[model samples]
Every structure is written in structure tokens, then in C-alpha cells.
Target: MKRLVLLLTFLCPMGFIALNAQSSSIFIGATGGANLSKFKFTEDLKELYPASNSLLGLNGGVTIGFEVQNFTLHTGLQYIQKGSEYQTDNFEDEQGTGFYSATEKLHYLSIPLLIGYRKYL
Candidate 1:
């Protein structure tokens, strides 16, 4: 995590500098989306739950883009929420219900850098 942060700290400034030096047409944007996530247990853990269900998650981020002629450079930073829930029939408390549920959540920071060329036919 620390390494990821450090790398981004260094790369972001350099990316901005490179974009400014090369392109006069710069564009900034923001993006957001939703995801459905599920967990597939391994063979050893399959006995715990018959199946896992999908959970709704969200992601959003900012984008920086530089364009010159037919070529473009793009980069962005995003935050993602991901996880899933599972119901198990084997686990039981003193009540003897033999049913339980669990949730797992994960948060992530994502950075994407891309370069592309566009052509008109």
C-alpha cells in the first residue's frame, strides 16, 4: 500500500508535466459507476455455503487527458468498493437454528494510464 502511494505520488506530477509539455488540448473529467460482486469459495470452503450472492458496489474517479492530432494520453485515479455476502446452513448458535450469514467488504484505490491513437475513415 505504501509503495503504491509512493509510486502514484511520483508518477502523477510527472504525468502532468509530460502532458503539458506535449499537448495544448487537455481535458479533465470525472467518472462513476456501479458493480455487482460475488465470491466463489474454494473446494475446501464450499461446504460452508451452497452459494454466495452478489452485492452492489460503487466506484468514482477523476480523469486527466491530453490529446494531440490523432494521439491521446489518459490517466485517472479511482476508488472502488467491492464485497459479497454468503449464507451458510452449517453454522449454528445455541438457538439451534443452524443458519448464519456473513459479509466481506474491501476498498481499493485504482489508477489507470492509457495511450491510444484515433483514426477517421
Candidate 2:
């Protein structure tokens, strides 16, 4: 299942380029970046978790674009991960308790399609 999706993601662009090869210019590139994810809480919640910090994440993807004259079409597939970590002060209750901590991690699959027109300077 995964392989099929990956194959299609790459092949679909090739198909477009092949069909437009005679009249359009083809562009293929790789993209990557860093992400800092953080969580903000309200006044009441902030008091419970005094120690909050941003988590580091990474993203990377492939890009393909076709240009015909001043008009262009582009698309890409990307994988992104973003999340945050939270920690709370220790609290006492009827039962013995320890400090509380939580980590959230989210994953995303991104597909962007774009059309563009260029202006000559």
C-alpha cells in the first residue's frame, strides 16, 4: 500500500512532464526544513505547567514544476512532523502522586498544487 502511493507520487509528475516535454520546461527539486512546535496555555493552565518548551521537528519533500511561457504548474508531496512537550509540578492527593509529563507528536502528509504566472521585468 505504501509503496503504491510512493510510486504514484513520483510517477504522476513524470507523466505530466512527458506529455508537455515539447512545449514546457521541466523543473525537479528537493526541499527540507526545520520546525519548532510549542504549546501555549491560558493563565489557569499555565500555572499548572510552569515548564513548557518547544520541540524540534524536521520536514522534507520532492517538488516538480512545468513551465510553458509565463504560466507554470507545480506540485509536490511532503512528510511533516510537529509536536510539543509539557510538564507539570508535583501534586499531592488522596493517593500518592508524582510529577506529570506529556509529549504530543503529530504526523502529516502534505500535497500542494500551485499555478503561477510570471511578469517580465
Candidate 3:
């Protein structure tokens, strides 16, 4: 589950907007270092236990938007999860064992701004 979320998060942003055959274009994007991280029991427990500020790893997913003249809508699905640390009293205890991971995934309609310079090759 966690890995799935990570995969989605990483992929969804590849081509959120796309043009038509007339346009024919590809998108370019990138991010900082430190792509994904290992699972942390403290963080996982906190995200499930309490509701507070938390830190987490990043996942990716890609969406392909079609071009309809001057503008277009990019619609697709996404699955993402984050590393967290709550350290509160609201979750099962794990002593040197291992905590199950958490993930978020869903199919969605994503609309992005597509100029007249994008299309399929």
C-alpha cells in the first residue's frame, strides 16, 4: 500500500497537461533530492493515532490531459502516502517489532492549463 502511494505520487505529475495532435508536445518536470524514504513506526502510528502536524515521504503519479483548442483538462488518478510521527496515545504499540504502513490512493479528475503547444507524438 505504501509503495503504491509512492508510485502514484511520483507518476501523476509527469504530464498533467497535454495538447492535441495539432499541437504535439511533451512536458518536462522535476523535483529536489531525497525521493522516497523508509517506513518509520513512530510516524506511521502518529498519522493514524492523532491529528496534528506531521512529516512524510513523497510518492508520485502521472496524468495525461487532452488538448481542446487553446485550453485543456488533465484528468487522472492518484495514490500517495507520507511518513509521519505523532507519538501520541491512540495507536497500537510495537516494541522492536514493525508497524504496518499507510497509503492514500484515489482516481480523480485533474484539469491543467494546456497551451496550444502540446500534443501526442
Q: Count the backbone clashes (under 3 Å) in each candidate.
A: 0, 0, 21
Give the Cα lDDT of each candidate. Answer: 0.88, 0.85, 0.46
Residue 12 C-alpha lDDT in model 3:
50
Best by TM-score: 1
TM-score of each candidate? 0.73, 0.64, 0.31
lDDT of 3: 0.46
**Arrange candidates by TM-score, highest first: which order?**
1, 2, 3
Better of 1 and 3 by TM-score: 1
Q: Write the per-residue lDDT of candidate 3 for residues 78-101, one digit (tens) a residue.
A: 445444333344445567333433
**What lDDT does candidate 2 reach at residue 108?**
92
Q: After superposition, how far is residue 118 of candidate 3 from its true place, in Å?
A: 11
> Which residues of candidate 1, in runs, are more than 4 Å off?
1-23, 94-96
Question: What's the CA error at residue 108 for candidate 1, in Å?
Answer: 0.8
What RMSD does model 3 have?
13.2
By the lDDT metric, which is better: model 1 or model 2? 1
* Segments of candidate 3 deviating more than 4 angstroms: 1-53, 89-121
Candidate 1, poorest ten consecutive residues by summed lDDT: 15-24
